[model samples]
Target chain A: MIEAQTLTKRYGAKTAVDSISFTVQPGKVTGFLGPNGAGKSTTMRMIMGLDNPSGGQVIVNGRPYAKHKAPLHEVGALLDAKAVHTKRSAYNHLRAMAATHGIPNSRVNEVIELTGLGAVAKKRVAGFSLGMGQRLGIAVALLGDPQTVIFDEPVNGLDPEGVQWVRHLARDLAAEGRTVFLSSHLMSEMALTADHLIVIGRGRIIADAPIQDIIDGQSKARVRVRADRPQDLLGPLAGDGVSSQVLEPELLEITGVDPRRIAETALRTGVLVYELTPLQLSLEDAYMQLTQAEVEYQSHSLSPTAPDTTQLTIPVEGRRP
Target chain B: MSAQTTTSPSPTRHAPRPSSGITFSRVLRSEWIKVTTVRSTVILIASTVLVMVGLALLGAWGYAQLAQSINDGSLPADLQAQGPGSPAVDALTTPSSGLIFGQLLIASLAVVLIASEWATGMIRSTMVAVPGRTPALLAKTVVVAAVAFLVGLLSALVSYLIAQPILGSQDLDFALTEDGVLASIINTGTFLALVAVISMSLGILLRNTAGGVVTAVGIFFVLPVIMQLLSGLADWVTDAARFLPGEAGNKMVAVTASEGALTQLQGGLVMGAWALAFLAAALIVTKKRDV
Candidate 1:
């Protein structure tokens, strides 16, 4: 298992990872989700002991990574695909790493064939394609057969088959009761592959729960309600935690509060309710909404006409939980 | 200590064995693999030897020609090429003379040994495998120093043997048993190895290919020339110049001591001190900064 307690990393005035705590349990895949620059890489680096945490600590198998005499055996991490020297052949690179742990060359060749790098194992990594590089990185991570494996953007630049292979690999690793934590910005992929999710935004944990619960919580029984008097009903219907938005002159979309409550509120306030349609959001929509307020490098498109663009004029209210 | 293994019905298909501890000797082995596996390392090492021996041959040839002219009584009557010392030994020293330039090439190998890891982003893998950062670096030092020393030794032996016959024909007094002759040849190798260690320290401390190479060159090549020029202007400059790492190392190969200069042992100590200081700085940087 991998556990991080109030782990933090700050560079000058900018905080890459804020004090955040979470646990990655074995027997399931935990997808670490974040927008770009959401501290995913920094957190992974700290976990690998490649970077010192500004505060708190992340432990793999109940100890800091460096404390383990054979860290590669305790935990395997593929933080970056470019970690291998470009000039070294993939076979030689793996052998060199294996040598440190007294691992034999035969195991190195096994991982090579397992990762399907046999054909190019002798070729220098400088010539490998992006997918091939990812394969090599995966090979390195699997070399020691650690109880916990962490990969950062493993599927980035992978082909469709390669992506499916990684998904299966992660599930298989977890199925064997290994703690598997992998990061990705692709929500659809996470939806398909992850059993649990730890979502981060602006260096803080936005959500950490089972995948279904997060989707349910974010897309919580949203219903479209049509009323003749939105302004009159807006205040009376706006109970604690209930978010209601007027879609048109006679249209209202409501979430957080159930449909029955919205109907009763409209009836009690003498606001005529015409239509109510419940809305279910996909994981993509859920993630976008969850991180809407938290993205650090929020892109402001020149096409202001695009609907659903977040407001640039006013400060976003307290971020949604 | 081994990681706590919880048997929770792991479905993992890959077979995993108990992890062996990371001993310094294994780290040395790993580092040796890292050094020898790369094509650049092999090429650079070969080049270092070639340059050293190649230049020695040229230097020996030049000396042989002058000696020949003296033997033939061709030069001015007052000019003497091989007066007393073994002209053969002098010729044997010619090939190693190229080591003056060959040291840079060897130093380049050392610089790339550490710096290229940073440049190519391999340090992450290397550090993760051996998290005791100091051991990881020291391992590299041991392997590179051995390789450099071997190259230095090979170059000295080849140049001395090849130039031996040429100088012997001229009736120059030169033999391995001669006082200081064998020591000079061995010291030449030691000097080359020390250059590599110092260059590697610079590579780790600087962590940039061009920066490390340039700094090593400045210290070993440029600084000595600058010191020589400054010596004429001040006596203290001479003292300081002799103490400089490159100049001090030069004394290690000197057959005869110049008055008011450090002995070979003192020179070796000074060069060793420079390597250690740079290594300590590299370690400090490794500890203070994120990889």
Candidate 2:
């Protein structure tokens, strides 16, 4: 398990990782999610003891990484795919690293075959493609048979087959009761691979929860209602714990009230209700709703108008959940 | 849907053992493997030996030819003895003939040995394995110094053997068993070791191969010349120049007192101080900097 408390890093005047705390538990895959420049890499570096944190501390398996007796066996990290000398061949590179821990040569060959790098194990890394490089990086990360593995952007340059292979590798490793922490900006990949998600924005934790909870906790749910007097119903519906907006001349988007309650109210008030549709939110829409206000870099092409929060009704053909 | 569950038999025995503690010998072995496996390191070692032997042979041949020409009346004897300490010059010539260039080459090799890791982003991997950092640096220093010392000694020996025949042909006796010859060879080897250590320290400090090499060369070559040209400004400057690493190391080999200069022990101490200071600075900087 990896635990970080109040970790922070500052470069000159700018802060890269502002006092963030999180823990990565064993027996499952924890996904570190963030936009570009959101302190994911900096945090990983601190955990590896590569960069000194300006404040706070990070512990791996109850001890600082540098203080561990056998750091390689305790934690294996692939911080960057190209953190290798291009002149050295893959086999020699692994051999050199293996020599440090007195690890046997047989284990090096095992990782080679396991990562499907057998063909290019003898070739120089300079001649390998980006996908090949990622494979080698994974091979090195598994060199010591470490219990806790960290991979940053492991699938950035992989082909589709390689991508599937990495996903399976991560899952299998986690199934063996190891701590698997990976970071990526691809939400779709995270949705597929990560059992838990820690989302950060602008150097701060925006959300930390289970994948299902993150999907369920977003505030984008709404019930769409259509009536002949939608304008007249807006004032009465705009109260505490209930909000209604006019989508069209006859359509009203209502929040904080279920479709059955809206229908009953309309029936009791003698309002002609033609349509009542409940919208189920997608993860993408939830993510947008949560991060739309927290996004730090905005493109010039975005118009001055805010995002449309009003719900539009589609013709009801079936009952909604 | 029914949840299908499939299970495999448990292991008959316990799981594998976790890795044991890290040993210093393992770190040393790792560093040795790293230094010896690189192609550039192999080439540098070979070239250091080659250049030293080649230069020694050339210098020996030239000296022999000059001595013969003077003996045969082809040149003036008074003119040969016109320079002070001509016998001392001829006696000490072959041992230190390859000293200047050999030290430069080996120093450059040492610089690259440490600096290339940083330049290629390999230091991260290295330090991850041995996080203490100082042990790795010390291991490299020991390896580089041993290789350079052996190379320097072998080159001087070869030069002595080759020069022995030429001197015999000229009816001039230059003895390898002589006191001065032995001292000179041992001193030359020690000098090369010092130069290698200095270069390795520069490598650690600069962390750039080219910058480290150039800085080492400037300290050994350019600084002394500049000091000599500005001797009129202050006599202490020239006195200080004698204590420079290269000059001080040469003084140890020649076993001759510099006129109104530091004693032999003082020279040795000066060279040792240089080595200690550079290594210390390199260690401190490495400890503080991010790998």
Candidate 3:
């Protein structure tokens, strides 16, 4: 288990990570969700004892990471994809890291094969593509057979197949009762792989809950009603708790009420309903709602009030709404 | 309940793995692996030896020719009367003729070893592997110093062996047991080791390969020249210039007594002081700064 209590990091006047606290328990994949420059990498570095925290502390398995006798075996982290020396071959880089922990060469070869880096293990890392670099990083992270694994933006530059491989790797590692904490800007990916999420925005924790709660709480449930006289039911549905907006002459977008109640109201009001579509909000939409104001950099054309309906291209099956 | 328990283990089970203690020997092994794996390190050590031997051969031949000219009565008697000191000078010069050049190469190699990690973003991985910064830094320092000391010692030995034949033909054989000859060799090795330590400290302070190399070269080369030029114009400046590290190191390398300078032991102490100051600064910077 990895626990961070009121952890914070500030660089000059800019606060990279605010006072945030969360625990990553074993046996599940916990996704750290944030946009670019939202302190995901900084937090991971602090946990690995790479960067000194400005305040608070992080503990891995009940002790601070630096205090661990065998840090590599206790908690392995892939904080950056290409942290290895570019001039050194992949195999040599892993060999040096493994030498630190006295981990056997067989384990290094096993991880290399496991990450599909067998072909390029002897080749210099400078020649490897970004995807291959990510594989090497994962191979190093798994070098010591660590109990707690932390990967920051693991699938940033992966192909579709590589992306699936990482997703499955994270899930399988979690299934083995290890603490799997991964960070990614890809909400759809998180929604698929993460059993729980800790969302951060502008260096502050915006939401920390189970995936289902975030989806239900932040995203509004809307029902599309199509009828001959969509305007007729607008008055009854437009009450204190109910809101209805006309999308077209025959279609009404109704919120603040479930589809069942809307359907019952339509039946009692003698409305000829042809279409009753309940819009299931994707995790992306929910994430946008939770982090709209907290986004550090806004594109010129992006409006804060605009609804987020952009399709998320996740490679996993069974998680798409 | 018994059947359920027999079917599967409890899902809430927690098994904490045993801790593996950090060993200094393991850290040393890691540092050794890290330093030897790089091609730059091998090239630098090779170049140091080659330069040392090449300069020794050149110095030996030049000295032999000079002695022959004096013996043949072609040169003035004043040159011969400079006396026994000449052979000491000749023997001392051969072993360290390439030192000025070789020291820079080895020092730059040391700088790159420490500074390039920060430049290439590899220090993050290193620090993660060894969180206690002192052990890592000490391991790196020890490794670099050991390699440097070996290179310096081997180079001096090779230079002495190569010069032996030429000096023999000139009727002036250098006894390895001579106080000046042995002092020069041992002092050269110590000086080279000192230079490597200073370079490693500079590397940690700057954390940029180019900056560290430039600063090291500037201190060893540029500063002494500037101090010399200034001393020639003023008497007080000449007195102050004696305390500079390069000047002190030059005095430390001399096989015979020189006019107006600190004793060899004092010069060594001055060099040691410089190394200690640089090391202290580096340790503080490294300990306080983020990787």
Candidate 3 TM-score versus the reference = 0.91
**Candidate 2 ranges with C-alpha deviation above 4 Å:** A223-233, A241-255, A265-297, A302-321, B1-19, B76-82, B85-88, B171-173, B255-266
Q: Considering TM-score, which of the candidate structures 1 and 2 is the better prediction for this target?
A: 1
> Which residue runs does candidate 3 get wrong by more than 4 Å?
A268-271, A302-319, B1-19, B76-88, B232-236
Tens-digit per-residue lDDT, A59-163, candidate 3? 998788888777888788989888888888889889888877777788889999999999999998889899999999999888878889999999988999999
Q: Which lDDT values do the candidates have, in the order given?
A: 0.83, 0.78, 0.81
Mark the regions of model 1 whose C-alpha exceeds 4 Å error after superposition. Answer: A226-241, A260-275, A305-321, B1-19, B76-92
lDDT of 2: 0.78
- Give the per-residue lDDT of model 3 (tens digit) for B1-291: 012112222234333334343567777888888887777678878888898778878888888888788678787778777656565366556776667877888889889999988887778888888888778888888888888878877887788887888888987667778766677777677777878889999999889999999999998888888888887688988887777777677666666767678767778789879888888888888888888
**Candidate 2 lDDT over residue span A1-321, tens digit each:** 899999999999988889999999776788898877889999998898888899999998878888877778888888888777787888888988887788889999999999999999988888989899889889888887788899999998999999999988887777677788999988777877878888887778888887777876764457788898876566556667887667688887787878887777777777899988776655455555556555667444355654444223322234211
Clashes of each: 11, 0, 0
By DockQ, who's the top model here?
Answer: 1
Q: How accurate is candidate 3 locally (lDDT)?
A: 0.81
Q: How do the residues B151-233 of candidate 2 rate in per-residue lDDT, one tens digit apiece?
A: 88888877777667766666554666665677778767778888999999999999999999999999888888889899889
- TM-score for the B chain of model 3: 0.88
Q: RMSD (Cα, Å) of candidate 2?
A: 4.1
Q: After superposition, how far is residue A112 of candidate 2 from its true place, in Å?
A: 1.0
